[model samples]
Target: MRVAIVTESFLPALNGVTTSVCKVLESLRAQGHDALVIAPGTSPWSPTMTPEHYAGFPVHSVTSVPVRQFRVGLPSYEIETVLHRFRPDVMHVASPFVLGVRGLTAARALGIPSVAIYQTDMPSYIRQHSGPAGDLTARAAWRWIRRIHQQADLTLAPSSAALQDLAAHDVPRIAQWGRGVDSDLFHPARRTDPGTAALRARLAPRGETLLGYVGRLAPEKELHRLVELARVPGTRLVLVGEGPSSEMLAASLPGAVFLGRREGEDLARAYAAFDVFVHTGTRETFGQTIQEAAAAGLPVVAPARGGPLDLVEVGVTGDLFDPDRPGDLAAKVAPLVGPEAAELRERMGLAARDRVVTRSWPALVEQLLDHYALAIRDFSRSVA
Candidate 1:
């Protein structure tokens, strides 16, 4: 099958959308499927860094403008031209916003079926980043999102919360499709690896419990919520990844150890070194980092909302705190910290790993292909 992936973000942008797109492309390549990527050009911050290709597939970059630390792809006739030439069996629109809207329009014009993947929680993002006009802007963003997804033959949401959100916004033809983790890369064995152990010792030098959080250190993440968690007795906070809120978060978090952005083995080692994984963000459409942390055999402590609701199995695998209650985070994390809870943490960590062990990228990609087939059939029926 030939597929065309039109994404809001891609290479050089280390976010959830980019990570999932890369995994999908890799899976498609391994399965003997032909695929191509249409994404924004490299941001001005990293002018020459974006790749011309990925997963052995050609990546056609469109003109883009900088938005904060990231680039946003603009609407272009290039999308129609690329789709016309590729003659894709299905078009995959990843996190439909500006670029995605154009991709969906082009697909409709060419009589091609398209699947819109709902990954980002834009309404919540608008509310978080838009200052006082946040509520009004968020309502407008929801309307925009509804129109964009309604254009696609099928819309795949990454979690139950996302699927429900789309349905509530009156977006049609919705389905649930979650992200996968690399169990081999993020495994229990890594905890004992020399490098990982050394890293853990460095972070928790005084035999303190290492509580970790991975992903961008941005405002929307609510990293400030961790101030109380950082103050927990017998626990040390470790943060991975970088973003616009880094310096501010560092100052507010006090003694928390920041590891910046890490990838591949380095990222895996960081996860393995953690005694517990804590996620502060309440607006995630799907918590990909939670899956990675769980795969690394760490008990997760995340907000009792959104994607984490589907990933963390409460007391069995980890714990979930009420996002509305600010102090709930510290309360939830307490059980997974300190030497007295070591056995409980270990059992929960093993359960967490077990929950995600079968959720491989290849398996998730197969599910996506099934969605594509459904979209194709739905489109054909509509035309007939």
Candidate 2:
């Protein structure tokens, strides 16, 4: 089947949503399905913008302009005009942005079923960053999202937590479309890298421990907590991404090493470079980075809340710390600081890799195809 994916963010940006979509598209193509992607001309998540191609898909760019406090690209009507000619069997809208709204409109005009994926909690984001206008911001976001998603043939959520949240917001016909990890690319074996050896030697030259965080250095990530974990003397913190908050975070935690953003083999090596992986965010619908960390055979330390709760099996894969206490995160990760921690890391990392391998991209794409078939059947009958 041919499928068209519409997301407000893509290639030029690096985030969970964009990454997941790319992986799924590749997986679908491997299974003999055709897929096309449409994304914003400029990404709000990254500063350096460059257009690129993916192996299995073609991407089209829409509007390039600033929206609200951030610069974002709007949807191009020409995209819809082109997709109409191609006539995909299904259209999936990945974000509840203007592009996504256009996806729904275009799909409706073509009498084709469309699915919307609830990837982020815009309401919560507004509440966190909208200052005193947070209440108005949240309400506005809720209204906008409801209008955009209510008409979708099915709404896909990455986690059960997200499903419950969307239900509360009155989103209709929801289905689970959990994110997956590339077991082949992110396994413990990929950790072999000159860069990893070099970084490890410098940070733990005298046998200090390495603790890592891999994702955007944005306000929503709760990275301050990760920085605070650096108080433990024998631990060297490695942050593997850059965002608006990178400079401030670098200043706040002087001992921490910022490696910018690494992708493919480089990213896997970075994950394996660390003794333990840490996450403090409570807002993730699903944490693909956490899964990638696990796939690299690294024990994880994350909040007991959000997607990590679903991925990290406490005392088995990794320990879950109390989100309220950054100190608890430090304590949970401290065991790995000792020499004995190396054995634990290997054992836990193996288990972590095993768990993530089960969520492979091909399997996830096939499952989503099943959901599409089901949605089409149900909607066709309803209309009949």
Candidate 3:
């Protein structure tokens, strides 16, 4: 099947949505399907970049400019035109941004089937950005998002938690797309890197804990908790990505080490190098980073909310703390700091890899193809 993926965020930008989209595209291409990507022309993360090939997939670039410290791409006319010419059997929208909405519009006009992947919590994002007017902004966005997604043949969610949130907002035609981790790339064996040991030694002295958070440094991440975590005696936080709030976050937490953005082996090493994987973000739909940490044979310390709640098996995988309290985060992470945590890490790490094997890219891509077939059949029936 020929598939077209439309997303606002992609390569050069480091985030869960971008990584997940890349994985899906890779999986589809591996199955011998013709897949195309429509992404922002200029990456917000890296300014000195142009249209580039991404891991063999052809990405169609569109006009983009900075918005709120990040790049936002305007709608692409060429994407619609290309879809008209190629006429992909299925189209997937990763976000309800302008690019994704345009893809939805094009698919509609062509009488083609489309699926919208709900990757972010837009309402939560609005609340994070809008402040005093956040509720109004969230409500308006909720309506707009509903309009875009209600037209989808089916809406794919990466987790059941995500589906429940969408259902609360009255979103229809929802199904689970789930998420998977590459065990080969993120196994416990990657921890043998000599550099990781040296790096750990450099970061911590005789008796200090190294808690890691690896994801976009955006407003919604609740990184304020990291600052509080830093207040814990004998603890240091290492943030392994960059984003809109890097400067402010740096100011707030002087002790934290910001590693900008990392990819491939470097990223895997970052996950493996950590003593405990701490995730404070409550808005994640599936929290891919947490899963990656799990794959690295690391125990996770996250809020007992949203995606983490579903992924972390409490005491077994790691401890889940109250989302509202920073103290809870500190409390959960404090225990895993000492020597006996090694056995806990080994146990959780094995279980984490086991949990992700069933959701392999091959299994997911096949399921996605099934969805595409259903969408096409429904579209054909509608046309008839």
TM-score of every candidate relative to the true structure:
0.98, 0.93, 0.94
Candidate with more favorable, higher lDDT: 2 or 3: 2
In candidate 1, what are the lDDT values of residues 245-337, reduced to their tens digit?
998988888889999999999999999999999998999999999999999999999998999999999899999999888688999888777
Q: Count of backbone clashes for each model?
A: 0, 1, 0
Flag clash pairs in model 1. none
lDDT of each: 0.93, 0.81, 0.81
Candidate 3: how large is its RMSD? 2.1
| Whole-model lDDT, model 2 | 0.81
**Evaluated with lDDT, which candidate comes out highest?**
1
Decide which is better by TM-score, 1 or 2. 1
Model 2 — TM-score against the truth?
Answer: 0.93
lDDT by residue (tens digit), candidate 3, 230-266? 7567777889988878999999998888888888888
**Tens digit of lDDT per residue, candidate 2, span 1-384?**
988888877776778778877887888878888888877776546566535556557777776676543435565578668798778888888875777888888888777788888898778887899899999999899889989997789998888888888888887888778987888887776556677787678767878778889999888898888766767778888899988898889889988888898888788778867888998888888888898899889899888886777889998899999978647888888877768678988888898888878888888888999988877787687678
**Which 10-residue window of candidate 1 scores lowest in summed lDDT?**
42-51
Candidate number with greatest TM-score:
1
**Residue 368, candidate 1: C-alpha displacement in angstroms:** 0.6
